[model samples]
Target chain A: MIDLELERFVYFADLFGIAIFSITGVLAARGKQIDLFGVMVLALATSLGGGTLRDLALNAHPLIWIADPLLLWAAIGAALLTFGYCRFWVLPRRALLVLDAAGLALFAIAGAEKAMALGFSPLIAVIMGISTGCAGGVIRDVLTGRIPGILQQDEFYATCALIGASFYVLLHGHLDANLLALSAMTLIFVIRLLAIYSGFRLPVFVVA
Target chain B: MIDLELERFVYFADLFGIAIFSITGVLAARGKQIDLFGVMVLALATSLGGGTLRDLALNAHPLIWIADPLLLWAAIGAALLTFGYCRFWVLPRRALLVLDAAGLALFAIAGAEKAMALGFSPLIAVIMGISTGCAGGVIRDVLTGRIPGILQQDEFYATCALIGASFYVLLHGHLDANLLALSAMTLIFVIRLLAIYSGFRLPVFVVA
Candidate 1:
C-alpha cells in the first residue's frame, strides 16, 4: 500500500511541475510569433515531453496524459494563462529561473522514483531522472528554433538533476521515501539556485 | 504466422531507412561544428526518434535498436561515413532530396504497418506513419538549430506520406502485403519527387 502522505506530495509535485514547465514554455515563445495552436503545442511538449519519453523508454503504456486527462487540462490552462498575462506581468527573469529550478527538482525526483518502482537499475534510474528533468526544455527550445540552453549554456541544470537523482538512489533504501525524495529535490533546487546566483558553469569541451 | 518474404522486405527497408536518415542527419550538421559524438547522437535521434515514439505510444517493449543491435551499428556507420565523405562527395541537392524521399516512404509504411500489427486504429496508424516519416527530419533540423523544414517549407512532404499511409491502410487486407507496401512506398516517393521538381506546395497558414 502506498503511503498517503507521499502520494499527496507526489500529486502536488506533479501538478505544480506541469504548470511551471508549461508557463516557461509559453514564456520562451514570447517573441516567436507562434499562433495559439503553436503555443499549446509547445506548452504540452515542455510540460509532458520528458515524462512521455521516460514512460516510452520504460515501455510504460497509455502514457501519463492518456491516463490522467487532468494533467493535459492543467498544461492547457497554464499555456492560456501565460499567453494572456505575459505581456502585462512582464515577469522578471529571476522569477522564471526560480520556477524552472523548482520544476526541474520536482521532475528529477519523480522520474528517479518512477524508474526505481519499475525495477530499473540505479544508474538507469538516475539517467532517466536527468532526462526527465531536461528533455522537455530541450524539446521546447528545439521547437522554438533555439539550441537547447542545457546543451549550449554551461549552467549546472542537468548536472544538478544528475547529482540529486544519484543521491536519491543512494539513500532511498536507508531512509523514508518521502524524506529521501524531499532531500534530493531540495538539493537539486538549492544547487540550481546557487549556480544561477553565482554564475557558476561547467567547462565546455572545445573541439580542436 | 508472419510471411517470411514480406518480413525480409521490411527488414531491408528498415535498414535502408535508418542508414539514409542517419546520413541525412549527419549531413545536416555540416557547418554547425558539432563534434563526432554530437553527430552520432543526432544521427541516432534522426533514424530512431519516430519509431521510438511510435513504439512508446503502442506500448511495444524492447525498442527495435534494443532488440537488434544491427540497427545501432547501421546508424553509427552512416554517421561516420557521412562525416568522412561529406566534404569530398558534396552530394547534389537533388540526390539528397531523392534519398530523403525514399527514406520517408520506407519509414512511413513501416510505421503504419507496425501500428496496425499492434492493433491501433486506422487514424492513429496513419498519424504514426506520417510521424515516422517526418520525425527524423524534424529532429535533425531541430538539432541543427533550424526550424523543421517539414513545418516551414511548403513542400508536400508529410502530405505525401499521409496519402500513401492512408492508401496502404485501405488496401493492405485486399492485396498481397509486399505488393501493397511497395505500391504505397512508390506512391509516396513519386509524389514527393514530383512535388520537389514541380514546386507543388500546400497553402501556408499565415498568422494574421
Candidate 2:
C-alpha cells in the first residue's frame, strides 16, 4: 500500500518536472522568432530529450512518451499554457528557479531508481540520473546557439544530480524503496537550493 | 554467397565513414584547447552519435560500438592520426570536402537500410537517414558552442541525404540490395558535389 502511494507520488512529480522543463524551454525560445510549431518542438525537446536519450542509451523500449501518451500531452499542454501565460505576464525568475530545483531532484532520483530497477551498475545509474535531469536543458540551450549552463560549470546542476543519484544508489537496498527515493530527492533539492543561494561554483577545468 | 560479400562491403564502407567523420571531428575541435581525451570524446560523438540514436529509437539493443569494438577503434585511430598530421601539415580543404560527401552518402544510405530492414515506414527511414548522416556533426558543433552548419541552412546537406534515402526506399523491392545502396550513395555524393560547386542555396525560412 505504501509502495503504491510512493509510486504515485513519484509519477506525479515526474509530470510536474516535464511541465516545468517545458515552460523553461518555451521561455528559452523567446528571441528566436520561430513559429508556434517550432516552439512546441523546442518544448518537447527540452522536456523529453533527456529521458529519450536515457531510454535509448539503456535500450529501454517504446520510449516513455510513446508508451504513455500522457507524458507528451503534459509537455505540450504545459508549453501551450506557458505560451499563453507569458503573453500576459512574465514568470518571476525566482519562482522558476525554485520549481526547477524541485523538478531536478525528482528527475534525478527517478532516473537513478529506474536504472537501479534495471540492474545497471551504480556508476551508470548515477550518470543516467544526471543525464535524465540535465540533458534536456543542455539540448535546449545548444539548439539556441548558447553554451549550456551545465557545461558552463554554472552552479550545481548535474553535480547535485550526481550526488542525489549516488545517495540513492548507496542506500537503496538498505532502506525502503519509497522512503529512500524521497530522501534522496529531498537531499538534492536542499543542496541545489543552497547552491542557488550560496552561489559557490566548482572549479572549472581549463585545457592548458 | 553474394549476400555475404555485399554485407562485408557495407561493413567496410561503414568503417571508412567512421574514419572520415572522426577526422572531421578532430579538425572541428582545432581551437577548443581540450585534452586528448576530450578529442577522443568529440571524435566518438561525431562518428557514433547518429547510429546510437537510431538504434535507441528503434529499440535495437547493444549499440553498434558496444557490439563491435572495431568502430570505436576506427574513430580513435582516425582522430589520433588527424591530430598528428595537422600538427605537421593541414589537409587540403578540397580533399576533406570530397571525403565528407562520400562519408555522408554512406552514412545516410546505411541508416535508411537499417530502418527499412527493421520494417519502418519510408518516411521514418528517411528521417533516420538524415539523422544518421547529420546529427553527429550537429552535436559536435553544439558542444563547442557553435550552431551547426547543417542547421544554418548552409547547403544541400540533409536535402541530398533525403533524396538518396527516398530513392532507396522507392526501389527497395525491385533492385538488388547491394546495387541499390551503391546507386543511392552515388546519387547523394554527386548531388552534394554539385551543390558545393554550384553554390546553390535553399530558400531560408524566416519569420516576418
Candidate 3:
C-alpha cells in the first residue's frame, strides 16, 4: 500500500520536474536560432538525463524513460509549449533560474528516495541525490557551451541537495511516508530558493 | 592469445578516441569565454560520455571513466593543450569537424565490439554502437546550443556508424578480432568522411 503510493508520488515528482526542466531548457536555447529539433533535444537532455544517470548507477532495469512513455510525451509537450512562447517573455532568464531550482529540488529528493529503496547506503543516497539534481543541468550547460552551474562557485546549488538528502534520510527513518517525502521536498525547495534569493554561495578553491 | 591482443588494441583505441574527443571539446569551449573548469568538464564529457552511456546500458561496473583514471587525465591534458592553441588556428572549425569524425569512428567500432563481447544480439550491438559513437557529440552540441550532427539531415553521421556496426557483426564470427575491428573502423571512417566531404545527407522529415 505504502509502496504503491510512494511510486505514484515519485511519478508525479518526475513529471513535474521534467516539465520544469524542459521549460528551462527551451529558454536556454533562446537567441541561438536553433531549430525545433535542437530545442527538443536540449529539453529531453535536461529532463531525462539525471534520471538516466541515477538508474544506471543503481543498475535498475528498464530505464525510467523506457518504462514510462508518458514521461517522454509529457517532456515533448512541455518543450513544444515552451518553444512556442519563449520569445514572448520579457524575463525568460529569471523564470528559468527559479523553475530550474524547483526542478532540481524535486529531482534531488526523488533520487534520494529511489536510491534508498534500492538499498544503497546513506552516503550513496546523498551522492545520488546531488548527482541527479545537478548532472542534467551540467550536461545541458556543457553541450550548449554555457558554463555548467556546478563548476561555478556562485550559487548554493548542489550543496543544498547534499544537505537536503541528509535531512531526508534522517527524517524518513522516523516519519510516515507522505510526511517524510513532503518534508524532504520542502527542505530542498526552501533551502535552494532561499539561497538563490539571498545570494548565498559556495566558495571556490583551486585544487593543486 | 588473440583475445588478449584484442583487448590491448581496444584499450589503445579508447585512449586515442578519448584524446581526439577531448581536443574537440576544448576547441568548442573556445570563443565561449568559459573558465578553465568549464573547459575541462566539456572535454571530459566529449571524451567519456559515449563510453559511460555504453557501460550504463550494459550494466557494466565502475563506469569506464571511473575505472580508468588514465583516460580522465589524458582528457584534461588534451583540453588544456587545445585551449592554449585555440586562437592560433586559422581553420579551427574544420579541425573540430574532422577530429570529431575520427572520434566518432573509433568510438562506434569500439562500442560495437564491447556490446558483442557482452553477448548482446547483433541488432542491440549495432544500436549500442551508434548510441555510444554519437551520444557524446550530441551532448557536447546540446550544451553549446549547436545542432547535433546526428539529428541534422545535412549529413550522414550516425548512418555511418550503423553500417559499420552491422558489418562488424557480420565479420565477427569469421575473422580474427584485430582484422574485424580494423575493418569496422575503416568502414565507418570512410563513410563518415565521404559524407562530410561530399555533403552526402539524409533527408529531414517530421515523424508522421
State each model's TM-score restricted to chain B.
0.94, 0.93, 0.93
User: Per-residue lDDT for A124-197 in model 1, tens only?
Assistant: 68867987898898889878877776654446678889889999999878998788888999999999999999
lDDT value, residue A62 of candidate 2: 72
**In model 2, what is the error at residue B80, expressed in angstroms?**
2.8
lDDT tens digits, residues B1-208, model 3? 2456887788777888999999988877768888989888888998899999888877777887789999888888888888777657565467887888888888998898887887776766886788788888877877777767555556577778888989998889798889889888888888878987898765332221
RMSD to truth, every model: 6.7, 6.9, 7.8
**Clashing pairs counted in every model:** 0, 0, 9
A76-166, model 3: which lDDT tens digit per residue?
A: 8998877666545465356777898889888998999999999999889999999998988986786667789877877788888898888
Chain A TM per prediction: 0.94, 0.92, 0.93
- Candidate 1: list runs displaced more than 4 Å: A1-49, A52-95, A120-127, A138-147, A151-208, B1-23, B26-45, B52-99, B119-128, B139-147, B151-156, B159-208
The prediction achieving the highest lDDT against the true structure is 1
C-alpha positional error of residue B124 in candidate 3 after TM-score superposition, expressed in Å: 11
What is the per-residue lDDT of model 2 for residues B108-208, given as tens digits with 9 covering 90 to 100? Answer: 98888887887777766876787788777777887777766664445567778878999988998898888888899999999999989988656432322
Give the Cα lDDT of each candidate.
0.83, 0.80, 0.80
DockQ each: 0.12, 0.13, 0.10
True contacts kept of each: 0.16, 0.19, 0.09
